[model samples]
Target chain A: MKTKFKKTLYSLSFFLLSICLFTVPTFASGLNWNGHFQTETRVNLDNSALTWQETNLTLQPEVVTNNTRFYGELCYRRSGLLSQNNSLLASTNSNPIELNEIYLDLYAYPWRRMDLRIGKQLIPWGTGYLLNPTSNLNPEDLRDVFDFGRYLGSNALKATTYLGEVTITGVFIPVFTPAALPHQQFQALFAPEMPSLPFTVNEQKIESILPAENLQESAAWGVKLEKHLLGCDFSVSYVDGRYSLPVPKITLTPVGEKVDLLCELIHPRRKIIGFDLAGAYGGLGFWSELAYFFPEEVKVTSDLTAIIGQHMEIVTLKDTPYAKYLIGMDYSADHLYFNGQYLHGFPQEQGKDKLGDYFLGRLEFTLNDGKIKIPFNACLEVRDFNKFQESFAYLFSPEVCFYPEMNTEITLSLRLIDGKSGTNLGKMKDWDEIGLKIKYSF
Target chain B: MMRKTCCILLLIICLTFPLCPVLKSQELTAKEILEKVNSLLNAPQDQKLTLKLVLIDKNGQEETRELIMMQKGKDLRMGKFLSPASQRGIGFLSLPNDVFYVYMPAFKKTQRIATRQKSGKFAGTDFSYQDLGTQQYDEKWSSRLVRAENEQYVLELQAAKGNDTGYSQLILWVSTENFYPLKIEFYDQHNKLCKVLTNHKIQKIAGYLVAQEMEMVDVIKNHKTKMFLEEVEFDTGLSDESFTERYLSR
Candidate 1:
């Protein structure tokens, strides 16, 4: 089955590439092509045993006719561990080539006020820079937490209409795709859980059941209305879809002096209502986004007779509703630019904490007509302030970029992390490292 | 005695009447001359043109770019890069009230340019966003004619209060025949000459007098950018719809 899927993907890629090269020039005068090639190498500061290298090449081509427009991108990436001595990280995929996006846009469709877009495309729907809680039309790509590049596009149909200063947009997605997760190798080495008891457990296994694409009821849809008024841009939207994160339905049983645990990953249905606003006053630019999510519940059962009880207890794991919001501001003066954001996540149910509230800031200074630049960035979690008396996790990244030519740049950076273990960013403290990258665009 | 007094008064009047024309010409103020210059420069309500820019470094290295631009009325303008393979599909749209937007082909995204970013260089050229569109002298600056000599008028313009600009003052040399600007010098906030722009060639096209070639030199950096108008058409029937965001990606 995997081989057949791979063959189909390869054939589709070739077909799209051929159309981009051959059909564009003959049909349109606005045909254009541009892309970039980059390479990066990273080394761990604490241990030389953990090192990685990656190389990427991308191609983007676009064409416009009188009323129809076509856009597409293709990427080839190769990454691997620098040292083979680490057996836990040796199972990762080292090479992959994929089609990032391909879409067709029809302008003034049926009228001059509406537009239609179909095929694989990204639908960005929020004002937050790093994390967009209101964006639910497409699945997120969480392979790298630090990088904010383009997310993987999904097959969708979108229609937009403009009425004076207001716009309305609608989207329909027929397929169900889950958000990509971090590499299993990295997770195994860094995400170890502490045991509460001193007993040895055996036969622990996890099984995930994703919603099949053939299920007609698994489709998602969303709508948004945007307007500019009182010198501010505002938007209100709602989405009914599946949650991007999986919920575990756990089962436990005790037999023959040993315990067996089973975890079945399931994606539950969810509904989100969101709002966003952005505006500028004087020298400061401000933006805010808020979203509220309602998720379905799951069932969990545990056998307690082996330790403290004589019966099996059945517990209900209810997915609680939560609200997430981010507020940010940006300012620039002379050659310095700065941006800061405050994020908060409040759950409707008490005693349940998802990702905690945090603050993020970025500062950049440019010199020599923007040929040389230095940037500093940091993020700090503000949860558990009174009890812990300190931040849960703190990350700092400082980088320098030099542009020798118009289309080329070289960058060097260092990533540092400090926190207590078992936390979101705290667990990755050992991954602190320095990196160098060079990219050329054409 | 009455006949002798009358003859002397008549002789005095005759001598003063011969100098009246010169005094009347000197009565022209700086603002009047600027108004005439503005009228001549903005004669067309709509226009379409192809522009070629050649940038030269201090060491004499040269790079060239070509673009097509269209303007409707005084506030709506759009430009698209046509040459230099890497930047060919980039587009810029300027609207009223200092609103601007840029379309990048590689990302298939059209993003609004912040008001504070107006002072940055445009497309790797020495020109800023404020320099590309139509110039409104009365809106931002006050002018005074310093002198008129050799059939040319030299004027000095100072920035109005509360106007955010990189330059504090500008000096212009305009031709008296057609009221066209021949040379201009820009002074930074520190009162230093930072850049100089000179018109090297002029031609009449579609019943409008136009500058065919011009050069902008950075005095401090010792670099220069030369612009040439390859083609121009006045009264091109352009409308507000042509400058909307819907057409930027196209």
Candidate 2:
């Protein structure tokens, strides 16, 4: 039976590969590739005492010729900080890092309407919306900078199929993490656990949750479905196995009058739902999601009381829900493109009564025989305490990008964030950054 | 004898100068070639075309399908591909960058695809996002005659002063005999050749001559796809409502 199963798997793979080789020819009529390199430095104009300098060099090479495709990227990053006497500071340190991404794509179609794609590539779930399936790796705000050279996703095997107006994608993610030396007597000291219960394996204690020794070696799976109907496009995603991190515990609830009550800690799972609509009349797009985390050992108790009492009564305890919603509209004008978006995120665990909100606006205009394209992007945030705490947390940002030629662009960005009366927010300072970038594309 | 030789040379120079002016006038400039092709394309009072397509690449493998096309002066109807689950049945594409509409037959509603998305693929075929538009070359492009080769004039065109198009420049080769387009190439803002369109199988239909088979290939990719027109009807009696979402759902 085992031999037969192995044979069947091999046969299936052979058949699929043959189909791809026949459908998508492996050669292009002309060879086309593009490479872009950018070096960026960030300085805090407000405080010379606190300064950060980083240089990033990235190279992306892609070849699309004949009917076959090939693409890969390589990147190196180095960052340093000079901290003088400050109220709160970590350590003055400089670090340089290098990373590598290598992958190839092959496409083929044997079935009448089905196309197969095999590669280690980023699989975006929604159409450049908030519920991005590939956001886990290359997380960037589309309104600000374009970081196409960043890693979009971990290495994975993926397949995409089209049925009528619906597109379905399935991916198998291969997780890989670095190994560390064995823990010696002193090395184990930082492990931190009760002497009797060295290396506690309790899934119940919300605050002290760690992954299994083989967590990074396991495989995760994700699937996405998209369809365009009427004037709207809708997509839903379900992913399992290590997609999201645990949500911090705000309170603990004890089990029913037992001598040893249950300590509850919960984290949210990752799930996404999104929709978009664009017609001749106008364009409306929206996306919303609910993520919940559940700690293994935590039991839901009556009138739960952990860490902070009664405050978490608002939270169901076992599964904490973190939610976000976005709505946008686009108006089609002859010489101008105008659009606006609203985003709101529900706090996961930081506070009981606060949620974050964002307002975004954009405009693009053309002139001088299509030689000059002027673009404007603006954003405003309200009640910004969703994932973390802040004293006067409000965010406002605006940017303008100009295209002098098809391959050339220059951008200027202005940003401001007002925290509460007192808070220690990391490298993020309330200041404006004016930088310039030039690109040569083929 | 010397005086006679000088007079004869002078006479020869005068005749050649006059002929140069006449010859320049006889030859069409780059702009004139573009205008000729545009005139022929826009001359048809009304036309409705339904054709079958067989897309083939360099490997000689092919996918067969059908499409219905219509054009009435400024209005037009491009092909609506109904195959493969991904593109299935989409709404017909209507023109003008402002009023571009796509009717989804499944939803029984016409949705408008964004203008920015017009450069994407159509029906998962080899055609580009911009190929679905009912763009009038004369209205959208300013033409200049580059040169003539093998009885066909090459025309270089830029987007007209008031028009907004994705391409920075386009080079088209038109046959002098019927003004039929033989081949065309599109360049992006970076002057990179992005798309190539070729017309083959020229035939005559109801007193109108046109290419019955055509292909649109992505020059930069290994994928070069073609669209073959089996039966083309030039002046079919198609109502304006045929282009409407109401009729599309039916």
Candidate 3:
């Protein structure tokens, strides 16, 4: 894996060098380079051990001509896997440098109001600040579990056309990529809690099944139509793709008094219909996002005693439609800013009958001419409204940021989470942590 | 002869009643003055300007920002930051009816700002969103002539009913020649002066009056922001499309 990564990096570097050499002759408005360097450290409150620490630098280079432009983002990382049993699996390609995004844009092509872009790019197709249910084209980036709203880019072709005040966007992606799971500790959160059985559990294993790249099903496409009216921005979209997260199919084998469970994780095919609106009235800014998902049926098979006696199957999921949405509002006055959102059903949740509700709020104060900022953020997840006290999970994080000079910032933050085990957030109750980050942009 | 005298007296009384108010006052009404100022401010169909903003702190330290501003009609305006790498690519669009939207380059997203947020500082500058917007004073403020001079008219403007603004009152010195404001004093709710704005180097550019240099001083904070016009163009025929979110994000 490391050798392959090095080869890819070398190829990319040579390609970028060639582009520079080619453009140096006809360069009028040449390439501009800028990005940032960041280092972050986090410590667990429960064990006082370093949970995460890394240093990375990103470089963004863009070349612009009159009608065409090229943009690229390259990141150099200095640290790899920390300590964990499955650290090798959790750490990414572990390359010294990775290409985050590269794309070429053609403006006013074919028509006066049309733009086309191709290559690895990010399509941020949602209006909500929280969980954007309308953003469905790209896979989720769970490298940092706390960075809740990040998405990975996709190599695709996109075209945008403006018809007066309306904009139409179409995208086609030929390949599918699964979500980047978090580190080993956080990756455990994706597993389902095992039910009590007569046999004592001994060992467990997970096997992930990804669709073959050559298959026709390993593709995604989406379209969006956006318009501004009534002093608001509105959009409707549709995506035909598969969910990036894997669902588990458990197979339990009993041996004497102990049992082993073989967990098979498979990506499910799904389609999404989404809509969103963003507008402000007077002193209040409001936004709403809605998405309905249609999924294919999936069954989990369990070996009761296939070698000794019998086989059984569980209908884990059936083809059903579920909805996810959020309504949010924000207001800023003087140096204070407040945002609140109520979300229904997280992206990982799939069942029509098993959706949860969450409330997210953030308050920030900027002082000393924006040299310092303090923000308090909170989230509450409720599995059952009737038993809110027993089936509720909550998290609180407060951060202080100081800007000592231009384009430089230092931030200190504390996060705490707690709840009963019934809620999803409760599974990570021991994740209380304190973190510090220093970032500088050029 | 007595009947002719009565008729003459009746006609004189009727004619003098209408002239009494005009004779007593030599100043234009607040509405009439505001209309004149609006007309002068919005004389051009569209305008494009390149400006450099210098911020001076109390400690004598200075920072600078560069931007391009576009305006169509009275209230449609868009501004994009061009320099100060941190603020570069940030843009805001203001349309009629107090609609506003801001684009953040890092997020690659556009957000609509609430009307009340107009009072907030823009991009860490001393100027608020309201100060940067191409505001129609006649639509937002109610005014009364405070003092008159040989070459200027002093007007006190109050926030109209149902209008929420950061300032309680503003004293404006309007030029008699072009009806353009030469200076303004901003007062807080306590009626204390907090900020002062002065325009200098007024020049006629392409048949329109333009201020070559402008400054806003926050007296309470002892800070100053000065803006210099690098390039100014009037009546450039900017379309409504220029004020949309597409261009703002671009």
Each prediction's TM-score versus the true structure: 0.85, 0.50, 0.88
A346, model 2: CA deviation in Å?
7.8
> Which of 2 and 3 is ahead in TM-score?
3
Model 3 alpha-carbon miss at residue B163, Å: 3.0
Top candidate, metric DockQ: 3
lDDT of 1 by residue, A302-352 (tens): 755776565544333346777788898887765688999887852211113
Q: Best TM-score goes to which candidate?
A: 3
Instruction: Please identify model 1 stretches exceeding 4 Å from their true place.
Output: A1-21, A29-31, A85-95, A188-202, A253-259, A299-318, A345-352, B1-28, B81-90, B104-109, B231-233
Per-residue CA lDDT of model 2 for B1-250, tens digit only, reads 9999999999999979745533543476666666677677656656766656555545555555566666765555645654422233455656544456665532324455665545555544556446655546776787877766676767788877654456788999888777778998988767788789899988776776677777777665545666666555555566564454333432
Give candidate 1's TM-score.
0.85
For candidate 2, the lDDT comes to 0.49
Worst 10 residues of 1 chain B by lDDT: B18-27
DockQ of every predicted complex = 0.27, 0.09, 0.54
- Give me the chain B TM-score of candidate 2: 0.79
Better of 1 and 3 by TM-score: 3
> Isolated chain A: TM-score per model?
0.88, 0.60, 0.89
Compute the interface RMSD for candidate 1: 3.1
- Model 2 is docked with a DockQ of 0.09
